[model samples]
Target chain A: MKLSKYNLGVIILILIASQAILAFLLFLGQPYFQLQGNSFFALLLLFFILELAALLIYEKINTARIKTSFGRFIKQIKLGNYESEESHIIQKYDFVNITDIQIELSELVGRIQADYNEQKRYIENVSHELMTPIAIIRGKLELLIQSEKITKSDFKLISQIMTKLDRLTRVNQSLVLLSKIDYNHYQDKATISFNDILDETLNLFEDQIRIDELVIRKDIKEDLRFNMNENLAYILIKNMIKNAVIHNIEKGYLRIKKLEDANGIQIINSGAVIHASTDQLFKRFQVEGGYQDSIGLGLSIISKICEVSGIKLTYTHHEGVHTVTIQF
Target chain B: MKILIVEDDLEILRTVLKYFDSFGYVLEKAKNYQDGLAKVNEFVYDCVILDLNLPDGDGIDLLAKIKQKNKSTGVIILSANSSIETKVAGLEIGADDYLTKPFHLSELNARVKSVVRRNKYEGDNAVRFNEIIIDTASQEVTVHSKKIKLTKKEYELLLYLVINKNRVLTKQSISEHIWGDFIDRTDSYDFIYSHLKNLRKKIMEKDGLDYIQTIYGIGYKFAEREIE
Candidate 1:
């Protein structure tokens, strides 16, 4: 029931052609018509030009409307506002063909949104379910060891096994945190000092930092505040610093510089230049060479946190110094 | 000390009961919300280890019931969910401390002792073991009335060991307790050994009795030396 502008243009062209042929036939029957036929032909040519001009104007308005509406829809999708996809795109116009495409796209988006949510829930539920048993197993093992039920030789083996379980627990916690960040699960937000977060995060690595004899140069301004989920903020900064220390050489230097604009923080650490492709650095389970202690989820979690928190993160390596800059 | 454990998981319940048996704690157990609530109403306890998940009801409601009945009993929430919201809710509802699941038993033991000590003394901050004394208020440790300075980590390590005295504490448990979740389990705990050495040296320098015993590649223990 809908005709496109191109179809209308074609129909108008055919009508003009038929009228022209009829006019020519009529003119052939009258000799006086041939005497002023040049002017008459000129008038007909002007009419054709006017019709084409009108068609172009109509097409221009039509395209502008479509472009604005579709542009808004795509913007909403990018901004993670999927709930408004149906209502914003449902306005009826002289765009029946476009309406068909919109309906199909809406359905496709709905399916994908549903699928993504299901997977997110699955990750959350599975991680949650895994924790209790892991905890119980750890408890039982500790109890067994405490009770001296095992021999001294077996104690060493049990301790090793416990370490592996600890790794599993860490991985579970990290995955749960990732899904939480991905789903925007932490809702409470407050203006907190990034300086405080960094200081607190660094405190966790005090032993390692001391043992490694790493030199720290800090240029953070006092009380640099940003609004974010407190827990996510802590994890983000901690992972960044941890990555720096874990990947650094003996007696390496760590430099933390806050941007003059007060909108970003940069961390530089002296280490062997990262040999992995830039693409692989932030990937999960992509541990660097000889860094067996790392499960490689740290940077991936940091990336997800940055995404959800609307912070920009960039990594660059120069002169054996690896730098990560986070723009708030 | 009299302690009550309200947990539904059979394995955890059995293990906790068995572990606490060695500590000589007068213990009670409940498996559901109703049972736990009824027990909380009926008996006075030094501390209650409450798990957040209970069949037939929520553990939060049970926590409320326990608080309504006895405001003095210390409650430690043991939960699998480590969300901040849950922790805040539990603490706001009068829980003393929170421990996420898959924790070391030694850590749990330490937390329980801390809670019980805090409740029993009601701001009485001194912990005494023969010739040594730890003032929780001052964060100070003394040997035979002579002051000994300890690092923050050394203090925590000493407190954790003393609280779980006579029990063989593994290096894994010790590291987990002292460093918390920040510890990389795959790495060697030579750092813990260093801290232990410092604590032993500081205690020994003050002419205090050295109670810390290494269990031959197992872990360290804080107990009275058996007169051999």
Candidate 2:
């Protein structure tokens, strides 16, 4: 029986008020009942007993009332279920102080939501505004390279600059994509088959697969469907396949299998053992030594998407195989 | 080929104009929304290169207007907006192709030609340059009518060079064109060398004509060179 500050205060007030009234009654009745000493004592005792009963009743009733009403409210808040429509009024059992706290808490939540929206808008705006200038610079560089006056050494240097600029652009674009996904821009979802998406994504890597002479083995179950943004799904599967292929050794084996419980998909590839810890691998810009060509945001983006979607993602390395599993 | 470039940035507009002019493409220019819309309404172009963000109005609206005016004209949206929604919307309406900004000009050149070919020369799918013939649909290449086996990257490299036969594509641009923005900056793009070498070898095996020429220190060039 946890008592709120308001309920506790109310009980204290009841005790103080009851004691004052009893003292006053005794003062007023003292002269008239002075002659009957025993009766006067009984009267004082009865008044004190009644006052004590009143305090006890108030404490019991209010404590239970507040516990039932505000306990659920706090639980809902803990669960992140912000209910703005709820008036915070427990019918027929409202405490003034509890009402005040509820209003303040509601206002706090509203402010948090507003701040979140503003930050999202700012990030998206920065991303969109950054693209134009990056494009202009890239275009200008290309034009400069195309000019006949530039010497061979100058052209080589300019090409290096172009490469760096391209990397910057990619990082910016990925940042934009991450924020967009975080903000639920791709909200329109439909039932999609992962098997089909995986097949198509594999087709995209057919060239790289052939070039590396990789052996691919698959045991994906047909018709494994999930509700998600199809484009994101394709990106997810593509990134995984790309990671497997990019890191795998030449003539390595790439294996993909659906979990027996139909809860997830697993990919295992024969590659050099990853030196970075598992947690570091998901971190942004944490690329291993040999995989220098990686943008390093691939796994980070995958991790972010999984986080927002309530999916379980895990990574492990054993012997020479790197394994990634995603449980939907 | 006649091309109309609708771009607000003066540098890009002028650069594209000069480059396209060298390609023998009669070009038209519009800097903002009103001028671009007016030009779209007045004349037909073999291809219209449009930017999504314009000064006066939205590029998507102009794209819709162009499609309404002339369905036959090829539309390629060149925009800095990388959102998938915008790409889908542009294509859903009537745009023939879409190219995100910071793109290799050579890649744009190839895409524009492919769009033009698809729209204008619907039946003729093969791109020919002297002895080399490229069938776009079948992804086949033949030198002197001799079928040659080339890897996917090699095929794309050959097709890219053939499309922009005389133009000089920088090594950086060639890497971007083939790898599609996946190549890292720290790593040297010398990997493109191996792909280019195999392609050259295959073509040379078919015939003694070495079409691919190294432009000293800059990059490789595919042109009709004097056989030494």
Candidate 3:
């Protein structure tokens, strides 16, 4: 709700008209003050102008009141009245808080732009991700159906199609989760132990690591904790370790060493040196070494966590080891 | 294991469920987030097939929720978002795998089978495809019972194609999968072509029918074409 009496010209014009009209009315209404009948009509006209000026000022006040309710309009939109018809604004007052309206409209436009950008990205990814298995299934099934003989060998392709379809299913879940993160879901910030969250998260993967014939070494400082949304933290650690395990050389070691200070924790992994630039590791659809299963979101989720919280995160490759440092 | 799918689109859900049912998989479903979460918290599943988009909540939130409840349950994130961000979410949430939408049901089965085999059938040694064999234990590949030697890149390419064969996989996908995500700095995909050519030659030399098909404006399809 904003009202500013900043237009001196309009105010001055009204003031002069009021003063002129009052003088003319005094001259016309008093017999002692009025000498000529010709000027009587002129005086009457001046009185009318003063009366009109008062009404105009009252109208201005009412219009300002109407515009002040714009906040309610915005709130309604947020509450899902996005499809509501635009309220028709009557009384064309030029230079009324047009800038404010523009700013709000611009923000609406920006959000729409963001939505489009996000949708475009998702479509490309879904198309790419979904298309792979579909193409495989369609192509293989097409081949198998046309063949005179279903080679005992061709049964494998059907199974292979099954495998990709399964991957497609998994990718879809990951995609849905990504959108959730984008919308800032799980944003209830709280104090969390860096080590505790890491350990708990690591436990989820411990059995898999053991089965894969890999060792898990931990050098995290006990009691090293900080304030953050625990859910995001869990996501950060789980993805980092998963990336380390999947990208590592066969029988290669998976290690978690956290360096804690007032700054933050650094989760370090010893695996095949990420040959790609450290930045790409965080990009969507960015995989390495033709690893089909890696939909390439390992570092991106960590980046999102940094964004939601005031945490600073950076990735570096030094001496064939990938280091993701998370600073509070 | 019976999987309960949470998807908004009935068509895709039906299609996917039908495909899984073909493979003798038992399935359950919910159309949105609340229903999906309820099912997840209530049931013990060997593996979960989760989607990224839901009407009530973000799929990622569900991911954290699911992981919090059962740390060991396998999760395979299924989404229309093949974004790097989403993939990382599943991985970070300790999900077993990630797949994207409009996908063939078969790819989903492969990842499901893999998760099951790894989680349930750990001692089973072979990940087999036709005459080609991948000893997941030793990371070895065999074509038609004759071992075809491959460079590291070639091996990965073969495995990727084999896993998603007959699919129209784009070159951009190939580059990302094989070369890591730092693909922006590179100049040409001629290397991918060269590798594909070499891989085809290796297979042909071993008397295997050439299966990699190039989709004109798009990418490659790893399926054997008619020889006529």
Judged by DockQ cut-offs, is candidate 1 incorrect, acceptable, medium or high? Answer: acceptable
Query: Which candidate would rank higher by lDDT, 2 or 3?
Result: 2
DockQ (C-alpha based) per candidate is 0.41, 0.29, 0.07
lDDT of candidate 1? 0.81
Estimate the TM-score of every prediction. Answer: 0.80, 0.76, 0.43
Ten-residue stretch with the least lDDT total in model 3 chain A: A84-93
* Lowest summed lDDT window (length 10), candidate 2 chain B: B181-190
- What CAPRI class is candidate 3? incorrect
Instruction: Encode model 2's per-residue lDDT on B111-192: one tens digit a residue.
Output: 8888888887456889888878999889998989999999888998889998878777767678777776544333234556
Candidate 3, residues B28-141, lDDT tens digits: the string is 888989988889889877777787777789887887887788776677887755555668767986888887644445456567766765766445657655667767566677
Q: At residue A167, give the lDDT of candidate 2.
A: 73
- List ranges where model 1 is wrong by over 4 Å: A1-78, A81-117, A147-150, A260-262, B121-124, B185-188
The collision pairs in model 1 are A135-B102
Query: For residues A262-301, what per-residue lDDT tens digits would candidate 2 score against the true structure?
Result: 5789999999876778898888888884776677888988
TM-score of chain B of 1: 0.92
Tens-place lDDT digits, model 1, residues A201-222: 7888888888889998889866
List ranges where model 2 is wrong by over 4 Å: A1-114, A148-151, B121-126, B135-142, B145-154, B171-179, B182-198, B205-208, B215-219, B226-228
Ranking by DockQ: 1, 2, 3
